[model samples]
Target chain A: MARAATTSDVFNAVAEPRRREILTLLVVGELEVGAIVTALRLDQPSVSKHLRVLRETGLVHMRRNGRHKLYRTNAPALQPVHEWVSTFERYWSNQLSRIKERAEAKMKQSRETGTSEKES
Target chain B: MARAATTSDVFNAVAEPRRREILTLLVVGELEVGAIVTALRLDQPSVSKHLRVLRETGLVHMRRNGRHKLYRTNAPALQPVHEWVSTFERYWSNQLSRIKERAEAKMKQSRETGTSEKES
Candidate 1:
């Protein structure tokens, strides 16, 4: 199968772990490329490439500050991704609640058995 | 750069729109391949391929029912993706709050000006 272009959409762009890390770092605030490189311990060119994909996909915003370019996450771009994943949230939550109910039932059964034994 | 394998991780596996559609469809309940093909309007081979990636990445679970195979979403596999994207939730929420504040301020100013005009 032909691979989809990473820069084509928010989901594709964020699929790369490096790009996600870059976006995570930017969430704190805008940072220059050099600062990103140092923070992630990645080389400058790799960081630039990831940032370019992110910028093109509208996942991050870049602005010029004199000779430097600063980047920050365009959080709204991630809304679609978040909303998509959130729909499945109920499945996990249901599993959790079921486990909680089982634990409570076991505790109650043990308490009732102890009381019956004491009465006998 | 060499493209990462889509089957390598949940993130890459879900980067494809078709695969996301397949997962969404499976969320309601387990379904066989033919049902998925009919619902998504995708050819059997293409749907099978996407399901393979989802299965390999543990995003979906497969089981045999007679001669047919059933598929369902392994929602917990998506926990990492959900957690990562959820961190950016505050950015959009903050923007919403800021917009709300501006509208409220505008309304208060209009009310105050209207009262002053009436008094004069």
Candidate 2:
């Protein structure tokens, strides 16, 4: 029995620049396989391979529309990726405050040292 | 000369679960090499290798303090990863609206077909 792709697979799938570009293209609107190949200027086999990886990652989904398979971004699976990256938000937000405090404390120490030297 | 790690490298580096755990650990405060090894319960060599990869990826930094090398998360390097992942934000927000519209349209479509069948 085969299980559906898990969220962790998405992290590695998106590591490639070309795959990310492919995802960006799909975000605009649904397109057929031929259209993706032409737009990205990639060879058919390469584009197909990337699309397969993206599909397996569950970041994109496609459906048969007449003779064409229309593909579009499946944004829900990206939730795990977003959540994992957001974990670092706390560190990013606090960085500014930490830098400011360090600078101010250094200034205060310098001023106090000068005063003590003058007194001596 | 080898180039320093770029933002893309950080994406690949943090893709590993253990690496992400290491980053999470550093978020609280700085820790010395020995402390990180003990806290994670990983061997010194394994932790050292992970630290090297983290440093090369620019996601972590170390400064020599006496005999110990203090390590901490370099939050700024994570900026690019954050920004990249955020591009999907528009898609995520729009998904809810799209799903609602689809559901409503399906209901309306079913009612219209039912009415037409009754007329026929």
Candidate 3:
């Protein structure tokens, strides 16, 4: 199957660690391209390239402030990614393991005392 | 910078839509390679390749079941991804918008009635 273009898909665009870092930085508030480059310690061209992919995928919004360009995260664009990953939340939550541990401990105590646990 | 290998990173492993589909199917329960191939309607080799990547990334676990290999999701491995994406939850949540809407409506009502609202 053909791969989705990284510039066109939010998931693909965010797959790069640098791009993820950029999004995290923008979350603090909007920043100029030069600010992002300085904060991330990356070269101008590389940052610009990532910004373009993020802009294309709608992960970040850009605006002009006179002579400068400001960028901020368009966080709503990440909702689909968040929702899809959240579906597996139950599988990873510690609550299930905690419950299992309590049950096993109770069972062990009952076995040692030879007493049946009363149903609640 | 060099890219992380898909076989080693959960995020990259799931970037492919087909792999994401496979993981969703595994969430139902463990399935054999043949079962996954049939359920996903992909070629055997393609399914096998995807399964290998999933296993290497620890997104899925495979165990021998006599003549077959059974696969199940290693959902705990997805915690990092869930945690990372969840940081942006507040940005997309409707609660903020709802609160803003209510405040705006109240302000509009107060203006129309020519009265100040009492502080709660």
Candidate 4:
């Protein structure tokens, strides 16, 4: 019998910053190996290795278009990750929202003070 | 100068399934070391090790409450992880939504067809 998929596999594959950057690049659109290599400024083999891990974890999809293999983000594989992170969103979201609100308030205050200062 | 925080450190710490589960448990409320270890059903040393990694990554906070150490999820530490994952959300989100739709549609279809045979 086949083993059930685990979240560890997905998280581990995505933990590498380089791999995350590659995924981000692919998010914009599909790209060939060369495009990714040039954009990331990483060794071709290293890029290939990260891609292999992502592909293995089902987080990425690749297709052969003539000679080059084009890679794209595989979204379904990422659902578990989102779900896992979302569990704590209720706890953290409020804090982030508050921080944002404070920053915006500060900016507004600064703008108002600037106008008054200029008038003075 | 201090080194900038790396996403790898955050992602790698969360990548461990046990550690993730611990975070989930802590999300509800603060818990002591004993409670976490018992809930996880792992060796004391193993739980300690996981907690150490979590604390080092800034993903968790601990305080001494009387005789025991209470642990809680540090929401700020997780923001970077969330941002990193959100980058690829657009690409994968649609695919997952489609799969969910298909699954729901199939279930609805089966319900509509009362004559359908049950699977073994």
**Which candidate, 2 or 4, would have the higher TM-score against the true structure?**
4
What is the lDDT, from 0 to 100, of the residue A7 in candidate 2? Answer: 35
Model 2 residue runs over 4 Å out of place are A1-8, A96-120, B1-8, B94-120
- Residues A1-120, model 1: lDDT tens digits: 677788887888999988989999998899999999999999999999999999999999999999999999899999999999999999898899998897777778778776432221
Relative to the real complex, the DockQ score for model 1 comes to 0.64
> Each model's DockQ?
0.64, 0.26, 0.59, 0.29
Question: lDDT per model, in order?
Answer: 0.89, 0.79, 0.88, 0.79
- The C-alpha interface RMSD of every prediction is 0.9, 5.5, 1.3, 5.3
**Lowest summed lDDT over 10 consecutive residues: which window, candidate 4 chain B?**
B1-10
lDDT of 1 at A61: 97
Model 4 misplaced stretches (Cα beyond 4 Å): A1-8, A96-120, B1-8, B94-120
Cα deviation at A105, candidate 1, in Å, is 7.8
Candidate 2 falls in which docking quality class?
acceptable
lDDT of 3 by residue, A22-118 (tens): 9999977999999999999999999999999999999999999999999999899988899889999887785689789888888998998977775
Question: Residue-wise lDDT of candidate 2 within B4-59, one digit each (tens)?
Answer: 23334776677666677888898778999899888889889978888898998888
Q: Report the lDDT tens digits of candidate 1 across residue range B13-54.
A: 889999999999998899999999999999999999999999
**Stretches of model 1 off by over 4 angstroms after superposition:** A100-120, B97-120
Candidate 4 structure quality by residue, lDDT tens digits, B1-120: 222233238887887778889988887889999999899898888888888988988888999999999999887688887777776676655677878887777788788885455453
